[model samples]
Target: MPAGKGEKQPYFHCKKLNSMMKNPKPYFLLCAALIVVSFPTWSLSKTATHLDLVKLKNGTVLEGHIVSQTARSLNLENVGGMISILRESIDRVITAEPGESAMFLGAQLLERKKFARAEFFLKIAAEYPAWRTESNASLQKLNTIKEQLEEQRREKEKSDIEKLIRRKGVEAGISELERRHSAEDDYWGSVRGRLHLLMARERLDHYDLKMAEQHLTLAEKYGVTKEQWESVRNEIVAMRRKSLLYGEDKLASRAFQSRKRPDKTAAGGGLLALAGEAKKKGEKVPPLEWLELVDRYAGENDVDPLLIWALIDTESSWRSQVVSPKGAQGLMQLMPLTAKDLEVDNPFDPEENIRGGIRYLRFLLKMFKDTDTALAAYYVGPGRVERYNGIPPAGREYVQKVRTREAALNKRFGLSPQGRTLSKS
Candidate 1:
């Protein structure tokens, strides 16, 4: 029907369609049909100022002027003329608002594969209804890809660790693993367990049963398998049995029992008081089974008990049965000849070793008249100290370790360098 004066024309009616339908020539009906199917294009002003950005669910962004809209669809006029878009396929609609233009910037960054910056802007733009769905979907997809890449990197690192262990040694593998995981606070439990197992095995090879057992406990806590735990445990038990069978544990146990005890008054009440106060303050006194034995012999030989404790800790880490590769045995690492000259019947005996080591250190202290020089003489020999007229180059590190350990022990026991108990400030 044609509209009368002041009456509005229906949106579907067009003059071009009417002309073609009325002519009725060959192809006239077909031409009219084409016009009817595509007659809803509004003659909107083709300018950037009047455009809306339509973002599709599939991440396609279309810039055009919205010609008309119905309840379920909208008509857009771009360079391609009229496109009818279903409302369900559209993710968002950005009108020609000034700030809404930045929503498309995230899409551009995403196209360039700059995911971090893309996510940042996308998150900001997602605050509005115009860009929420697309932004969140993009973030989810980006996170998935990032997680995949991180997994690949971790897998590659694990492969490298295996290669390093095979080519070099377990120590090399442990160094590499520790270097990588040092920055991570919460690493995967399985990987941490593997690291602990490696350390346990290494310590076992070195015959450090105490450290090996400690690492094994940590390994099991982290997630090591029962089989691996059993294997390390058996090794530790075997090593301990070997030490006992050689009379190493027996002689040490007997010597410790036979050692003389120091009188609290003779050794100075301050030292005993410091230990008691440290215990009351919930501090761990340095772990030495023969601490009073050390004090008794050190007092007899005119040596500092703390210095003796430091030497024992550094030389053998408190393992009474440990023997060095150089044939130095016991907590003090006394060589066979040194043990003989000092009249130590069994170098593995803790009491004899401690007394002999304290006597030898006292002689060195009197001869060298310097604590560091005496420590250096103890590590390398009095002959080496005499040849160099001071601590040798190799013995400097030994001297430093002993002195550092002595200082730590002093702090631990609340003692000062002048043999007086230090008061807490």
Candidate 2:
């Protein structure tokens, strides 16, 4: 009674479709599962082969292409660069397992100086072991490029550096320039070093031989190498001889005319006065909490007491309780790993922290040459900071602030009845 298609039998297509519509859940679930299973493989296959890495738990990572792949060790293109982390030493790969790969591609891109591109690839490469070696290479290379870029910025910035010279003072200029040498940039101090050389030159220009000798001595103390130092010394000696023989009064005014100090409390100098003034306010130098403890610890290590004092002031404002967002701690703000390496029983203790901080400073000095470079290290974790080619924002502020305090110490001691250390007769 109900079927009336000219009294025809039920349609087979309608029957099959009606049956499917009755329970479509299985079909829907199967389609979704296929997508879920296939998506990652598609994503992986989509990667273009350029830079790749094989990660190993052993101290080494491999950088090259995946010439072949299995769950186990993959073939790497080249194995040697200067560092020991080179490829010849990769004894094992993921325990020689099968059907496995981890490639850090983005890191590899960075090595090629494709930062924007590397940034994209590296983000993905982080997901695979093959990319780790490349990723690390990329990071190291990227940092190197960043520094190169920063240095390129400075050559055009000579006038800016010169303007800063008046504000940064002798110490600031020294600090800034020395940092460049240590960072492998070698440009920051070039101009100032020239100025210092000019001091010797001006002395020779005039016949005031004695004053020139003193100024030359100061220049050498600022970090010129023995070659540069001896050269300056010889020039000074030669000029004195010439002046004595040829004439005196002609250039006399030139030698006698020394450059005047600019404003006392400008640039980095303002901070320098603060440390001393803090004492006047009844807040002890290095703070009573840190001063005694620093001496006890620093003296034990044969480290310079003043250098430790300077580092702490720069690192954490002498606050034993301070902590950086990066988890650096104490008056000296040692990163936890560094604290462990230095064997500080308690990183927060003023004595131990200063001791470790000073040791670290000494290490940095040997690593980079002079207090200025060391100060940069303490402020931003050593020569790595030079990757930015100059003082980073934090490092710049830290250095100025510390130098200001050190300057205050110099002033206080200079005026004190005790006076500074005396030269041997």
Candidate 3:
């Protein structure tokens, strides 16, 4: 006979039971004893197989499967379907199979596209062969998806960089590239080297020779070709020599213009011309009286005297009574407001002016922590440098000029260890 739905079939066949009918009394007694002994064991085994134990702080106990848990709550599957219990209300959960619990959680995370976390639990689940094959397949798929997403991100980044270069020009583009290079996990050294070389050329175009040299050095470090390096090196040397000659001529011309009286003009012009000639003959000119004052203040402020000399040379050409068209005065070209802030009563006084300027320069150096940026802030304004994220376009030449003059003065005085300019442009 066929068994009905939800009915338990008898263990013995009807024909075998008919054979036992001859000894019906003994068979009935045996059947009753078997039921008495096996029922409790069957019930115990069934309860152990299907349920997890949950104990609560309120002295309540529950038997159910744990569906999921978070920091604040737990989802449980019970005979009542599903129930959410606040973690604060629960004391402990005793699951039947830890491996099965991990496998369930991993599957949930996989569905949510949390690939990294999913892989972690899935790897643990893989210790059980029942979950190993599915977990492995999911891990492979997760890796593939991650790779595709990364490739798409890189393509978008490259496209954006091209647009930036075209729209904002090389300096802005290089700034963006540097920011991205620092943040990216897989940085492209070749691309960075090419961008650095482009920036070096731009600096050269602006006559920022020291900055160009630094960029070229970085380019070589990042993998510029040797032939390209040599060509750039030759260009830098030629440009530097031309720049030095031009600077000397400009200084002499400015000195000639500073003297208004005819008698003093000839003497001043002659002295300036003699200085130029002496420089050409590789002879050192006598130091200005103001140099001693600058050294004293710079030392007192722990600032570089050569840097002050460069600033003075660029600002007023070492003229104590000179004033700029912009109303900056004295040897250090202190503006009226800045002079007041520095407590300088007379901007015409060389000692007071140099002291105020050196104090300000030291402040800028400490604030920016880079020589080029500090000079840029001094030349334009700190606000402008902050706005531009570096030296402003208008001030690049000024920064380069000051750094170039500083290098020269340092070399002449043997103040720098390497006898080379240290520009952080």
Q: lDDT winner among the candidates?
A: 1
Off by over 4 Å in 2: 1-283, 286-289, 300-303, 386-394, 415-425
Clashing pairs in 1: none
Cα displacement (angstroms), candidate 3, residue 107, comes to: 71
- Judging by TM-score against the true structure, name the best candidate: 1
Q: RMSD of model 2, in Å?
A: 24.1
Error of 2 at 360 (Å): 0.7
Cα lDDT, all candidates: 0.66, 0.55, 0.65
Give per-residue lDDT, candidate 2, residue 235.
Answer: 70
Q: Per-residue alpha-carbon lDDT of model 3 for 299-335, expressed as tens digits?
A: 5556665677788889888778988886789888877
What range of 10 consecutive residues in model 2 has the weakest lDDT sum? 416-425
TM-score of each: 0.35, 0.32, 0.33
Off by over 4 Å in 3: 1-287, 418-425
lDDT tens digits, residues 25-107, model 1?
A: 95676778888876644322111123478999999999855545655666654443335677778999978743233345555
The TM-score of predicted model 1 comes to 0.35
